[model samples]
Target: MPPQPSRRTFLQLTGVSAASVALGVSAPASADATPARPIPDGAFALGVASGDPRPDGFVLWTRLAPTPLATDGHGGMPSADVPVQYEVAEDSGFRRVVRRGLAIATPDLAHAVHPEVRGLQPGREYFYRFRVGNQLSPTGRTKTLPATGDSFSFATASCQAWYHGYFPAHRDIARRTPDAVFFLGDYIYEYGINAGDNLWREGVTVGPEHAVEIETLEQYRLRYGLFKSDPDLQAAHAAAPWFLVWDDHEVQNNYGAANSLYGVPPELFVHRRAVAYRAYYENLPFALDSLPDGPDGRIYRRYDVGSLARVHLLDTRQYRDPLPVDEADRLSEQRTIMGAEQERWLYDGLRGSRTPWNLVAGGVVLTAITDDRTEQWDGYPANRRRVLEAMGDAGTAVMLTGDIHRHVASELKLDFADPASRTVGVELVCSSIGSNGDGVDTDQYAKDWLQHPYVKLYNARRGYVHTTLTRSELTAEFVTFPYIQADANAQPNVVARFRTPAVDPRLEAL
Candidate 1:
């Protein structure tokens, strides 16, 4: 694959001239100054979102999906390009307008718009909205990371299968309004809906459009539409910016690199992956640099949130070796989860990081759970050790992860078998937003897994983790809901809290 384009290169290719787009303009012209068609009634049905925040600005996103569930995957948009106008303001009422621009919603991209807005003040809140003729999108709140600050906060969540339960966790996350949300994969499941599996939500069922597995580009786009149509999930996206990475479920379960779980050939799997990846990019608030190149994209990038923290978002599913079938294969020294390039990048970043808290966010768990080697860091022990050793008493290192559908707190040791091995860092695994139905507080798997001394706490429920990072310490809360399969009104509460002191990589219950 060729190297991805830089931000300026992408803008030039897309006809989005950064110089022409001005700030502090109350009203901007249409994309080409052409009279757009009459605005459709609910063009912003999927709602508005922002992501990939920088110190100076962030990306704003919206899709013209008047009918999100349309079978053709066009989202009820015209076959031609539609000009959409957007504005950024310092307040909710749009009185203090700052940045304004226009971006075309093309039919080829499912009428999606990603405006890479810049030239804004750092460490301050800004509100943004989109417009087309008389239609206006919901106002969304976003902020740039402080250039230098003493603190920051974020939430980690993943694995939200719409058919399993309601999105009460997302609703609560929206209410908390964290600075950013790290969505660690399983954004949308690839399985076809089954009535037998719809035992949760009473009187709720998947529509005909979602009754088949997603494979083609159109199908993947429609699947994303189905998930994004959820009111609770839409609210979460609108409330705060998100940083995303994908896992197997985004294409198919257990897919690694070019491998698929159903024994499909590598050549065929690549096509499916390309389509899924394209749809994923079109639906999120990702910067142009993250645009897909065939079956590959560059997602492993560093986000420096001032002097307080540095978040290294990783892409584990795209470059990892296939699942090991036997113990010898699992223990092979050549096995890698982050590929060679990403591994080198991560090591260099960790070694040269200047922030007080260094956060490595990925899609799967890092701590060893048991002898069973399946799909997490346990399957690639050699590479995991390399990463853990690179920290080497640097500033505080923390691993934020999702997947496994359970909340986990554990100590990251250089060697799991060696009890004397030093604790290099800590790993906090957030539970699913709504997967595996309404889960119990504890399960047989949790009982068997807690036998490991490094494993600290386990809660099997539907929720996310909220974290607060400061110069001195990092605090994390495992927030959970009583039930979500049947109760859309379920509320979230903190079930456990842990604190890790700076320079001391140990989890202490609070």
Candidate 2:
């Protein structure tokens, strides 16, 4: 990589003419030619991505990480702000540039930039790239949602641990080229590397640098950098815009609100959560509205995919009560997974939505299970009932979930124990990207889950759920990979498939 430039040198070299002018930035000269100085070798090593698609446009993101795994967590960038230029073109070749802008990659935010691009045509595919002097970031393709439409395709994935295995599932997701990806959390694991309790993959171990649990801001930032360094993950991000929600592993296992699983005091856990939340915002393609306010960030929101589907992206971890330890506690009416405010918001959205399909995207499973899985909706019975009742006879609802590390297709019922209760919707739980290493086809755990008739399918594997939503019906394919621990060339296979007709909410095997 080229030597780090001085603050003055960077400003002088990047703050030049036409591009700055287009973005309304006052600069010295026209930037029609390359910089007089040498460009850095890996300035855009982390790659480019876009997300949160609107009818007009979406957010474009990139970080200047020439040295991605630096210990200081600055991505090997200088302390000064770097002016990065971006362009949106109708073609990948940039021959028909439409929008050009400049954004400052600030050091305080770990040299990341999120430019809220707007005024583009709806339902149109656009190619975007970032530039710093003569250096160019990887080109990324993103599309804006249409104002009205009949069909849309999206994939749901979650629980990608860097130490667990290779990200063959992400590569497969890129190849599928979905319109959007719903990443339902555990985006990063918080456990210390090589802890011996969890051995990641067979014969493969985590590096020494990550051998300690991440607690501080720098540590968390570095952890995210390490995961983002994976080329497969980068390819997926580059392929389609992502809608993300973080589960427990983003901070610590089974952490609820300010409560820690290790019995850490609430006061201290809040500080840790603050750091994790800030780092999460800095790394992902979230808009400024999702920026962290101390330990809290507004992640629960809604997206309209034309007239086809209404996606409610929820945050179930930030304001929920801790997991119940006993049956009495689990059945408590006061116990909540989605806090009161979020619950109201979701209920109101479901009651008033006019879209053909109502899709609720969440971090944990919503379907009723036979086991006492208090960490999931099984523990928050009252809240789950409220949601089901809110959906009432709407019958158009579907829940997309992750975090169980297994693929499941289940019926959402007012009561799982009683077959006479009304069925409100269907829940599709996607398997992990690569969390539990190479999973088996059928395990004792899978058979154990089959005790509940609501669970139509259960598979222990590493992959994602691909779904196609149309005006007539919704089809879901449980895409899985045989191995991920060592097989980079692993291909995804459809282990099972199901479909739900427009007015019928039952998940029937296809």
Candidate 3:
């Protein structure tokens, strides 16, 4: 007879099973030294990271993985002060140190810190690292935007399920070495997918022997740590500072504030959201103002890419009412995705912005696609129309979106049905980094939809979008990998290239 599973073994089997499924391995023995390591009693684990950099500053983040590395949120690590030192320099070496400071990693925030490093030269490349006593975390390199009027390049990506596939795209993004990376959402999936079973029999296994059920702060931390364990993600963070936002999987599926589509109870959803938000704030390099408070939280903020672009990061999840099932049209307008305040904030930013390109860093697709039952902009038609109208009137705007899980370059027309109206702005939708769904295919139905003059390039491929912007023009390219699970040395295929005039918004193939 097979040996009976112990309580510890049972917990490991279910809680992290999805992670194991991703790795394509059976649950390994607990005695494996490769999966477990011991840091010095006072040492911080999980290394360090930086995010959301402006011309003058960036947010640095790190956490103290609980002493025993508990997965159930009950490690009982007390609130303690961990002194963290941050350094920035022009050279990778310390010879020409420009900025240095100390900040306390407070227990109130699970021993995480986000030190906003300021007073640095703009548009120049710099290196930074965090230190605790003699132990040094990974050194990260970043660049601040040149003063407004300077032209530069940036990249955006989303939907990186660590277990779903490899992150060779990060390696590719690293090679291009853009000024910054915009991470839209789905940073982590909360559910446990089949590990090396059914569709993914060849995937490599990682952790949580079974599906994840807990939504506590500790659970979220473990998930983030698992993703950070990927060297590609680590290298991506090290390559450049990132502007980020979250989508459903970070908390639960199709979560809309008071509830989620997966049938989580209202109060239970609130608790899970609280835990997820707190964990997200702790793990990410966000400003202190974006911190969460138990259930109700704020993550919507904006980043200025100097005079080249003004990025307005909006929170589409936090304020949304529960999704409507049958009466989609009523909820389309009655339901508030960004709520009143955030919508107003976005509108104000777009209307008042003077940047050549107004990049709206949104979590969901802004353009409407047919038959997409998921919570896309189509489900919120009124909201979509309002946003498109705003972009049309604003004159210079571009929509960058995730949640579609496929690469598409579409012309934002006055209407999808009516092909005659002058195109308002160019909307570029990027495919997932590693999602469960297939890539966007240019099928007959897809081509039929693109019949509208505004609809330009439609592709179904697993890859990322690269946007190169300058004072003269803006170009968007859908860089596709040969396969989602390809090895580290995979090359990206430029499946389709679309460009638009910065003065007038129109999609044209290069």
Per-model CA lDDT versus the true structure:
0.84, 0.82, 0.69
Model 1 stretches astray by more than 4 angstroms = 1-30, 33-35
In lDDT terms, which candidate is top?
1
Once model 1 is optimally superposed onto the true structure by TM-score, how far is the C-alpha of residue 475 displaced, in angstroms? 0.8
Evaluate model 1: give its TM-score.
Answer: 0.93
List, residue by residue over 369-425, the lDDT tens digit for candidate 3: 654554766667666677777776664678888776777677887766677776777
Q: Backbone collision count in every prediction?
A: 1, 0, 21
lDDT of 1: 0.84
Per residue, candidate 1 scores C-alpha lDDT tens digits across 296-329 of 7788999899988878999999999878889999
TM-score of each: 0.93, 0.91, 0.85
lDDT of model 3 at position 125? 89
lDDT of 2: 0.82
